[model samples]
Target chain A: MTAHPDMHETESSVREFSVSPERLRLTPEAIERRIGYGDESAPDNVRAAIEEMLAVFDSADPFRCGFRILDPGQVAFHPDRIVCGKVIFRTGSIIGRGLKGCSALALLAASAGPDLSERGRVLISEGRELAGYVLDTIASECVEQCLEHLESELAAATASWGWRLSNRYSPGYCGWDVVEQAKFFSLLHENFCGITVRSSGLMVPLKSASALVGLGENAERKDYECSLCDREDCIIRNDG
Target chain B: MKETSSILQSIAQCIERGKVNRASPYPPDLRDRDGADELVRRAIDLGIDPQEILTDGLMTGMKVVGEEFRAKRIFVPEVLMAAKAMTAGMEHLRPFFASSQATHRGVMILGTVLGDLHDIGKRLVGMMVEGAGWEVIDLGTDVAPEDFVAAVERRPESVVGLSALLTTTMMNMKETVARLKEAHPETKIIIGGAPVTVAFAHEIGADAYAPDPPGAVDFLNSTVAEI
Candidate 1:
């Protein structure tokens, strides 16, 4: 139920946290892996594209993240809906089971800046498909790094309470309905990290991701629960 | 003729290395050298057939890219760069191709189904197919069943490809395949993306499913050969 001291005071009901780009340090190897290269050396052209994309990301400080912490006691779980404080989440058994033993929950949203997505659009328009693809992939990595940063911050904040952290669970993964993203967003301030949910439940910027992390003594700390799902093409599942 | 053949071979090499033109700085070894664009143009100026430039130069290079991609020796960024280089060479030959002075292997209509704005996979498939000497009519993202049906009607001989990145949006692909099949049962339909699998393709009654762009190209080639 406690908010981080670094949260920016807003006029709206939502609490906002300020996350810097310094925290989201993406590595070349990680970027390569995300683009499906794995441990193998990327081709020269692919490596060059990654370098160019890293330069673009370096010149701009466009990463941002916002989150809110909720007490587990305030969350109510049902068959098809989860009520967290004032917000109601229309989730399923997957999310329900995932968050079972949490003393606290962190609702987070992060983006790799709007300009990154804009640059992708411009590159696509100019027929720079390679550049666009690299940018998009890098943006995804950047957002993931932002989540990593957020998880570290949460770990630090909760260590005093002897709480362990569960890996982040995102809507649209592990059978959680993507439509629940609207409810997750409702708890955050408007324009949180400059990411907007589309009518189709897809996040705008196309590179933004929202996730929930459980914090408690009993929370299981492990890699993503990909084995529980049937998505055959999941990169995380395949990598594991 | 020997010089012209050499130029075509150079163009193919440029594409494999992802050198777009003299102005492009990629593949640092090829920096400041005439790339696919110039080499392709020079081949045409030397009276090399436009179709020869396409088949012997662009398609040959893309075939290597496809093989390497399938083998996991290269990834998306590499394939995309090669596609860009192939596109640079193809631009010069478009006029000849449109005038029927050059021939394409077949036509393909590609798109991401409705409610899905993700098109990177679809675009990659389109580029690879185009580089493989197929005429690709990209319908872009959020394409409805009607748009696909309309495009199929316009190019009755064309194959159709549907891509979707989200599990939620993947249902739209099934609906699109069903509609396309009901309307033009003879048209070949291929589906792919992050969430699509061969099993899903079969369940949806799609003609084929490719896990990646190169696989899509291979499917298109095999299907067209059957016809």
Candidate 2:
């Protein structure tokens, strides 16, 4: 391939994350904005703060992963190779269940690429290219950490029946709704997404996504291939 | 060519000075002044050419900030302030832009890459490109290689700009560039943001690595000249 003319830039990752939390003194001013901590003065907020940042930290960590591709017809999508879609479910509360499902869907979309067999499985892109280097690492890690958090939370929430989650998929960018995103978001965890919906249902921090994850029996798994899906606007859906 | 004494010179000064309109309060002492918007309109009404206004006035102000930004003399906040000033000036000239009397610096496609959502750098490039007289098509944050490629298919001759704030994502710049080349070989690519450097720009085969928006302007000016 002919090389682009300006490909001469050297990549430099940021130097801030090197310091251990113990070596550094925690200033309220410093950590507050870092984690998007709302009302530092609120009681029980530090736990919330920890929950928020630690969840991001967990998501950014390299996630233990597993994948398999079923026949294209076995999934819910057409042959659009770029769609990242899934269904999610949990044993108990609706919100926690949806949150777990949605996060997995986001991971499937944002990180999963394509399996080598072409049968269809979660695939990671060559690398996450969200923005700049530091920003991408930060966002990618946040997503990974979110899945870990959701998994643990779902474990806690389950009392009777075990829950199962399919893949995660967002709207508008795909064949999903540019409108009705609010209802989709109602099923997510915002602080972890680093964005919140306002009274009008607009997501703050601007950059965010929502998706549907179906919950069902293990035999009922419809491990959908993005290629089989038809959402063209997907930022993650790409085989071309 | 007309001498620099054309009405375009005054219009350029208005933009550089952030004078939006006569009644605007910004630039405190210039209060009750007719800023770039009015100045540009008057110049147009008086038969000063639109292209002249763009090249001479608007481009001049943006070029100044681009230089300041590159030198680190002005940071993000200040450049943003200048951009605000430029916006006030450009509002009245947008129609001329659309009509083609005032041609853009060039068409440039800009965005943050996939798995990345940070938009400050891409957004900055967009402002600077717009300020520099180019019509920008922003794909917003988390742009996929396919998106960039598809957009190039739509506007074949335009320059493509890719931004990444993370080291990890910067690597993906290679793939996006690859897709562009495979599909659009003649297209030029520009890379930038905190994590990028000139050497890396070359490594990815992008045409330019602008440390700041002014460098991008300089690249486009030269590129246009080459064309």
Candidate 3:
């Protein structure tokens, strides 16, 4: 996929991508899979709860995403760390492997905003746990959808440069240490996309996601599947 | 009054089917029937021992729910519904427990370790453990290592469960476990979360590792049984 022309403006330029909740496609099957229905259809109560949550989902705040493209000089790959500009991310082997052979990097941060996560938390506290869980799943799906949308845009933006983008890899996944989040955010504008990493490495709003997309003419474009992760206890693995 | 065995069986059934009360419209097949709420109340009014209701009724049904969940016969929504039903019944036993007429199998102190804000998984494990008739003291998310140590200090017999979804936070889990272990070496600590594994559990000196809610319930129950 080719990167959009406008996305290649400058190496240090941080661009915002507007993705509306309306743009997100929350499929019933995807929700079912996440909530542990497996291949079976969700029960009536589950279906009703999902419908209710979906009906009010638009009331949540708008989603936000921002990205900065780093040139080859600004990006350096190591077996144990990835240096983006002056910031060094100790991503370990899993992330280092993915960034191998990359000439540039697209650092992106995306969030479902705070409203949905807050609403879900409130619902759980009120004992509407089933509905709360459904909302949580929806919020997570929203972030994933936002990331997917941004990935496509990045794809179209870099394709002209003959750059192939690998799948997005986020901190706290594939053995990447989340402590590197501080360095990750340093590459972006202050509170870029309205997301902030706490001292604990937790992004405020609780539903935010960040990742690095390696871009190079021959960047293998490896699909970092969750199954490859040995953490058998990982939620995504259990959800599947 | 209904036969004691029959009432207890009904209470178990209500819990298993997620029937909360006669007013609850779930499980369509059991509509209008006396649910855990009514059945448990009736059992108590009949002078049946509260301990029996807890063991023969709530725990009995929750055991099945845990097994079904482990076997994947049911999922989160179903388990959640069942926990609701179990909670409805447990409400009736609260006074008895307070009066020392009934007792929890064991106490569990659970939390998402320091630096981790993720809590849904921890809450799920708490609900399952509570449904299994353990008293769960949930410390919520981003709990400090000292907080865990202090919690276990309050209830020395309590088993601690540390949870974290992020790999970075797993370091915090290790720290929490070490602090708890240092303070109370006898304290049994169990750890679980998306990024947590048996190897990590071993690395951090945790007493056990549970991959899912049922696994947590099973681990806690087994520990108490051993005691």
Candidate 4:
């Protein structure tokens, strides 16, 4: 198989993409962690279930991401809103603080595809609630993995310009209204990576994610976002 | 030792390890051995009280699973398998339970509030609560406030649980809570989901907020005790 296909062609449309699943691999521990297992050893049955679901994931071509680097001239940040090209975002304190210093921005959207979500629903209909839950959790992690891979690609690309990529910030994080998901989708091409933003700002496939990453020389990086938020019982905080 | 007690203990072990039946190939060590189904049947044949089989056998195993889940010693897949094993045993006792031979700890009405299609959290809590000895009435996802009211009208003493995974649909949960409170002010309402918070629960006037399935089980048990 080709290491990374430059684009994915589908019956409905074609995706002109940069990051692909060629470098993406799902680890059992990562999926287990997303499903609420920390460092604890998974039981025999749970491990078997993880293996079973992993086989399904391996067989299905369920991952894709699309991104574009836009010039700073096309993006403007106001006190309450951000205008990137034709798309506008209602900004919050966290987003303003994160995007403080940047020369350009990278708008990215990623999905683990609809097949995984469909499989999860099928499991639920079959009364396999556990299997369904596991699938959902794994799908969530897969999108994050896609984001991580995108970041790596962005980081390398930005380094060539003596710039760094800021942490990926999504609409729902840090007081940003989730309604901006529509705005994010508007900036991207139609059905980009098969992720559709619902009217309510929720994404289809239920496991897709969209975010903005600031690119500049002064962009800061953190080990985790726990310190910036007030979620006291966050598993990431507990892990630390 | 009474033969029934021994059989009940074995059944409880089978449920804890997620051994469904003699034909199950899981938990390789127990493959080709009597599982929860066979032991439950043998206990029934030995005249073990169905209620005792439920509380001492199925519920006992589930309690351990719940505690382990709380401690993060196990995750969803393991608890689900345990639920499956418990279901295998419960299937044999369903008729007896329906005939009023088995007593439930309490009645809980569970659903994913309207406009929310997410049911994974609701189902986990339902299975966990049922395993903890409650009779759970699961109203599948996209349940409206009127549906909750009608279910509450049928069982006025039942506690209600609402779940929503979206910031958008979480507003619907608030509406369902408000409607249920207006119709049955005394009914306890517990809310949970990915976007739900303790502050949000208080804002929505929910009686309690459960962060996980075990937390929900604990909340339900405590609420039942209060009543």
Index of the highest-DockQ prediction: 3
lDDT of 3 by residue, B1-227 (tens): 35998888888888888898999888889998999999999899999999999999988898898888888888888888888999999999999999999999999999998878898889889988998889999999999999999899899999999998877788898889888989999999999887778998999899999989989988998998898
* Candidate 2, A1-240: lDDT as tens digits: 121212222121000011222322234334433323334432132334334444333333232221112222222332232222343222123222233322122221112111111111111122111112223223434434334444333333321224355544444333443334444444333342344444333344433333444433331233444565443433345464
TM-score order of candidates, best first? Answer: 3, 4, 1, 2
Weakest 10 consecutive residues, lDDT, candidate 2 chain B?
B72-81
Best by TM-score: 3
Model 4: pairs clashing at backbone N, Cα or C within 3 Å: none
Evaluate model 1: give its lDDT: 0.81
DockQ order, best first, reads 3, 1, 4, 2
Off by over 4 Å in 1: A1-15, A27-30, A37-52, A58-62, A76-100, A186-191, A223-231, B1-5
**Candidate 1 per-residue C-alpha lDDT over A81-192 given as tens digits, one digit per residue, 9 for 90 to 100:** 5677677776677666776766667787888767887888898798877777888888888888788877887777767667788778888777677777877887776788
- TM-scores of chain A, one for each prediction: 0.85, 0.36, 0.89, 0.84
Cα-lDDT of candidate 4: 0.80
Q: Calculate DockQ per candidate and list them.
A: 0.49, 0.03, 0.64, 0.45
- Range of the 10 consecutive residues with the lowest summed lDDT in candidate 3 chain A: A1-10
Cα lDDT computed for each candidate against the true fold: 0.81, 0.53, 0.84, 0.80
B114 in model 3: Cα distance from truth in Å?
1.8
Q: How many clashes (backbone atoms < 3 Å, residues ≥3 apart in a chain or on different chains) does model 4 have?
A: 0
Which ten residues in a row are the worst by lDDT in model 1 chain A?
A5-14
